[model samples]
Target: YLASEPGGRHVRLRKKGKTASLTFKVGRGAHREEREVKLSPKQFAALWPGTAGRRLRKLRYEIPWRNLMIEIDVYRGKHSGLVVAEVEFPDLATCREFKPPRWFGREVTSQNRYSNVRLANE
Candidate 1:
């Protein structure tokens, strides 16, 4: 589940099988800062109903790459058939210096339409 708080912050309640967390995030793209709190099943259940936003479900695969990790997300449910790959860098300089593999496809990092919040609404 997802919600927007004041000042454009995002709150996300996520569950993966038996594990869950409530996350708060500010900013966007590579500049975002996130904080997560672990949640038990009971806590998740109580908070689930209060959460409001489009729900998103995806299977993420982490692959080790040259000094970085490539995260591939295969979306499910309403957003099925959409696949996206992302990589995180230590800083803006590193991010700018990086080149994508041939199989990485088009880059959409700067596209707001490709953002998770927008994708969920689609």
Candidate 2:
């Protein structure tokens, strides 16, 4: 990421339709902590230009599957045609027991290449 620190901690500004937010993340991998704060349109416009090379756009859809929710992201712009589905778990045991549908392809859980920060890199 263009403004990311040495570690996994980073701050990101996201614009979803007419809404905007600022997200702060800490730690790395699957156990990271995150917090988001909504931003005004004016605030977003002021901060957006500074994030020129570090941006990506995607339309996310949440699908309810049994007891879990699957998040599907349809990437745009530089990563056009890229689609990913993710399921969040509260603990490691749950993640281990989850079974993906046949439609799912190879898993890239720990791969650095598929990470959002890398995808957004210019």
Candidate 3:
């Protein structure tokens, strides 16, 4: 789920297969800056409890499209039917120039209701 760190950073701890990462993001929309750090399992466990009721589970798949990559999340547990896709751009220019495939569905960028944290609570 999406959590906010101190100093107004958007934070989330992601477990991809066997690896875990702590990612910090700043700004909003297409120009956000992000940094990710590999976390030890113990470190992940220590911080995970804070998420408590906000936790969500998903299976993520990354697909290549031109120079950009598309990440699709297939949710699990109670939210099993929900699916979401995300693409991060290097800049606004790249974001504007990109075209989605016919099947990509509607854009939900910056929508609070679509965020994992919000969906988790429902």
lDDT of 2 by residue, 1-122 (tens): 32677588888888878999988988666667878899999999888897888888899999999788999999999899989888887777878888998887788768768878778874
lDDT of 1 by residue, 2-120 (tens): 67743548888888879999998898776777799999999999998765447788999999999999999999988899999999888889898899999998989878878887776
TM for every model, in the order presented, reads 0.86, 0.85, 0.84
Query: In model 1, which regions exceed 4 Å deviation?
Result: 5-8
What lDDT tens digits, residue by residue, belong to model 3 across residues 12-96?
A: 7877777988888776545678899999999888888766777788888999998989999999998999899999888788889
Q: Give the lowest summed-lDDT range of ten residues in model 2.
A: 1-10
Q: What TM-score does candidate 3 get on C-alpha atoms? A: 0.84
Estimate candidate 2's alpha-carbon lDDT, on a 0 to 1 scale. 0.83
Best by lDDT: 1
lDDT of 3: 0.79
- Give me candidate 1's TM-score against the actual structure: 0.86
Whole-model lDDT values for every prediction:
0.84, 0.83, 0.79
Candidate 2, clashing residue pairs?
Answer: none
